[model samples]
Target chain A: MKTKFTRPERRLLAASCAVPITAALCTNAGAMHIMEGFLPQGHAIAWGAVCLPFVVWGLIAMRKIVAQHRKAVLLLAMMGAYAFVLSALKRPSVTGSSSHPTGTGLGAVLFGPAPMAVLGMIVLLFQAILLAHGGLTTLGANTFSMAIAGPFVSFGVYRLCRKLKVNRLVSVGIACALGDLFTYCITAAQLALAHPGEQGVLASMAEFLGVFALTQIPLAIVEGILSAIVLMMLESFAKPELREIGFLQKEVVKA
Target chain B: MSKKQVVTILILVLLCAAILIFPLMTIRDSEFGGADGQAEEVIAQIDPDYTPWAENILEPPGGETESLLFCLQTALGAIVIGFGFGYLVARKKYRAEEAV
Candidate 1:
């Protein structure tokens, strides 16, 4: 394979690879996104199986993206990195689940949901193995919530807002925020289903939902605004790239 | 620069302030737990006999250390991904301009 990487690119790659290896060597704590060994074997496997098709589809979609728009490969990789960084910046939440923005909202808005599945899964995998955050067993459940469900909702909501003629910034904000909230809701439901309390699955789900809402709601709003800001920055600085990606129509830019 | 941009920024700042303030006001005495920890507690309360089917392959020496490692890992990942993406996009632009 004739590969071309400049000196700076090689340096960047070297530094990036070194950081993870050093961090992995230093820590054993194994942080939690649903925690390690939190789920029963059966539930874990089931969720993993459920996620299989989406992942496969995402891989195919990613392949197509690379084939069709070679330039987008970088954007996709950046989106994955953005998600990892955003989600890892854990904030305290009332539900006791360390909360962070999923970053899928912005991704979905820019690249749509299917590709997000691939990007999200990659981010989760890195977090699991390198940082000891989120475990192998729970990868499926986490992937579903953060990657699949959240991005889909973001895409749906963004499109709906656009249809309703909402202001572009406002629509992006609402979509991203709602997307973050929905990720948590799905996560809570997953937990409730796995270990329903005396009140049954629905009641337990409600409990989880209520607890997460205390922190997640605010976090979602913040994420929404952040995503909107990011979008605006991209519009101003990366307008050609955005136009090429179909995120910003040429007519809209001209107008 | 634009009015809308200013409004967006203001909303973001206010929301951030609210997030910080609301927690302080309501949970002054409580130790806020992560969702994973709280979920475990809830499961135990709901079903006393419930046992985790698995355990972490490795346990860190301390919570703070674990957090440190996580931050480091994320920072590294961000740097790499950011650089790679930037390089690719810039390369594409350069190539296009050369052809033009």
Candidate 2:
């Protein structure tokens, strides 16, 4: 089964796998920080409103997918559980705000964004009830930002890189940056909505970019590096592991 | 992509761009986001002595459950419960379909 690949083919294969895998790992890096009541109330409510339709769509999609495979239900449920638990273990940051990784990106990359949304909603619900990291009223908002938007950004970045025929390392680096930054942008938007008396969208965006830049930019880069590293490791050592996680399939290679 | 799809994507992108630039579209830092009457009122009702008590306990010493452990346990429990329920429902449905 070991087909000898030419150098160009090897590079292409590596690029195809690394790009998406890098994004997936970056998503995983943020896996559980979706705390409730963190954003302004209005922001949370607004996002929640946005999330409702998505939830319905997501549930329909998931039911179809899960019916095809019962194990998918187990995986999604485990993912939600993972998010809830990781969120609860947050340490206090210098800003005096406790933060956790949402990890939605990671799960989304493994499964898909639609399933992740459903799973994320479940996690957010549990986080609110058990740990009080977020609130019941704000669950939809948190889910939209952390679950929906975050994964879209990660998945989008991966697909964009693939379309561009970008190099593996650089694609991963860029994808991670976008994935993390997308979450921050969503957070800023949510914050702006919930709180009143902001200067404007531009000003708030600037403020968020400015404040989060110092931390988020560096964090994004770090995540990118970690994701690249993980992809490389997966590529070289444990490719079968990637297959198990749905990163690769025998059919994709034949195509 | 189709012509209609192209238009849809353009509109969606433009809308997000608009929201990204405007903070007031989201609201501003007011009572909800600030230290104002709402916080005071909620605090007073929830725990009147919270201010002084917070000062004393801002940094608790020794022997506390880390947040990570707590999150893990919670997630594990949720997964077990959720899967258990989902499995039961799916199994029942599958059986019903078979019977029919």
Candidate 3:
């Protein structure tokens, strides 16, 4: 078995993690678009209230994953931190809806969903405490939509692709698009569930989906291509190490 | 199975259950609480001209008090469905590897 990441590549991975964290902290919508006061105080409080155990459970899970993949954990944590900060940054809209990236799919595909949930809770807590982007009540709802759902979808797609023997780039791109779309779909569902009386929930959801598709689709494609590029580069440049991490197929490499 | 494989599988299953089930167990009932449902009632009580189209979109039907039982029931159904799909994929992957 060989290692995957070259020394420089390891540094790059580490850097990728840190970059998102800083971006998340600085930009309200670094990856997710959260509008102003979209979730009510009561809603935020309710979700935030549910977020408590999730945070605790996430911390426990993170500790376990870190024991096995210290560097990966650090990088993933940074990404989660970045997501948190960005989630806190709010944009005002006439539509009275705030949206944010459900990074769960991306995170789950990379690091698995359990730790991603922890990462999301941390990010949400930070955003609520420091930036006040979202309310304390709505943390659970946000976590469920973004952190939990996103990653699980991505992971599922990736595994299915691997089994199907699809081209690596195609697999990643498809996963990215689906993952992002699912996040939005889940958010729409949540909104619907949260406020069924809103006769326009379906219409607004459709409208939001239409508006979001304009940018998100392309963004998903870009992200997918980038991830595939990085992973493929790793396959050639750092296959031996990545193989050890169970990301690459041992059979693919001609011994 | 190797220890690593066993550990990985165990964790994977646990995470899947958490992602698919926890939401159902802990999900709040009144997400639509105090927003649209009440607004509609108020509109109906007051304006009488309000159609469903103009009513606030965030509130629930029958008032702000959400049916926690309903959310949990629906969540349970969703989890079962999600798990079935996940299992199908996992089984497919396993079979493919066996063939190869």
Candidate 4:
């Protein structure tokens, strides 16, 4: 209700409708934010249903976090802000198109995927309302891919990497980059599933994956480096905050 | 920042810049469109009659407004992140001075 397209935007939306059957002929090369009214009603509702539980869990986790450490509120806001700033930028890709970074990885690594589900959802909601980039109808599907699935993957990878005794920064970097890639992968799978066409889901998935692979790989690397830099900055200036979230060891804290 | 941290961050910055710039240099006059539109096209191709059953509630009047909205989103996010970092740095300094 809060987000819709203007007439001119609808026309531009229609203008983009006249696209090549294959991705190669896409003249309006753009980022991967699913636009308004793109997903069918059933798919939209199903995705929304899938996201609801995660989002609810995120809110509960957020409450527990605040109860544990009041200062974590700032870190939480920072993570949400981090996600928005990164996601908003449409970086150029080798495919000669652009797509955004999910930006949820850092938060997932720091605070776990649950809170990020809430933060990422807020960012997606804002993008839908203000930018008309992603639509409300497809919000569930988009949120599931970017927020729920991606953050879970990021958090899991971060834990696994740390368990494997990889360097902290390197682990976080890998986790974040993989999270971004995973978001796009889920998006492709979701789209392919909803529109299997004549060739079926597997073939459609391959086609969708091909569309995103070249562009996303480089973007993922960029995301990893950027996330690592942010982690370093936080380490230098925000030790107490990091400690609050259990990201920094007790030895790292100033006496 | 320590020299090592500074150098590392600088190298990372350069790496990100190069990665983004490479695409622009190689692809002359490419539209660099969003992947979402391509997916939409694929959906349409797979099923020509699949009309989107829903519509966005609010669309910017034109392209300029859309750009403006996007800038606004980034600006808001940047401000919050900046404030968060600034607050943390100042708090550290305050604690140090208190100890002294």
**CAPRI rating of model 1:** acceptable
Best by DockQ: 4
Please list, in the order the candidates appear, how each scores on TM-score for chain B only.
0.62, 0.32, 0.32, 0.89
Candidate 1 chain A, run of 10 with poorest lDDT: A23-32
The TM-score of predicted model 4 comes to: 0.87
* Model 4 per-residue lDDT tens digits across residues A1-255: 011345664554344333322323322211125666776666676677666656666766787778777988898898999999998898899998888898999999988898888898888888887777788877878888888888999989987887787888999999999999999898888878878889999999888887765579999999999999999998888777777777776324521
Q: Give one digit per residue, the lDDT tens place, for model 2 in A1-255.
A: 122345664565455345333432212111112233344344444455566545555565566556654545555555455445433443222222223445555445545566667777777665555544445655666677777887678767865775687765456556655665576566555544433233555564455444433334434444454445434433343334345445566425633
Best by TM-score: 4
Q: Which docking band does candidate 3 fall into?
A: incorrect
List of clashing residue pairs for candidate 1: A28-B59, A28-B60, A29-B60, A96-B33, A96-B34, A96-B35, A97-B34, A97-B35
TM-score of 2: 0.54
lDDT of 1 by residue, A46-157 (tens): 6665565556556656666687667667677767777877888777654334567788888888888877877887777776765556777788788888898999899899
lDDT of 4 by residue, B1-100 (tens): 5899999999999999999999899999889988776777777888687787766678789979987887887888899999998888788777875222
Judge candidate 4 at residue A152 and give its lDDT. 91
The C-alpha stretches of model 4 lying farther than 4 A from their native spots are A1-32, A250-255, B97-100
Residue A143, model 2: lDDT of 73
Cand. 3 Cα-lDDT: 0.46
Summing lDDT over every window of 10 consecutive residues in candidate 4 chain A, give the lowest-scoring window: A23-32
- Residue A80 in model 1: lDDT: 74
Give me the runs in candidate 2 sitting further than 4 Å from their true place.
A1-45, A70-98, A166-177, A196-198, A209-213, A222-247, A250-255, B1-100
* Per-residue C-alpha lDDT of model 3 across residues A86-202, encoded as one tens digit per residue: 333222121222233433444455555656667765565444443333333444566665666666687789878867888765676567557766765655555444444445567
Name the weakest run of 10 consecutive residues (lDDT summed) in model 1 chain B. Answer: B91-100
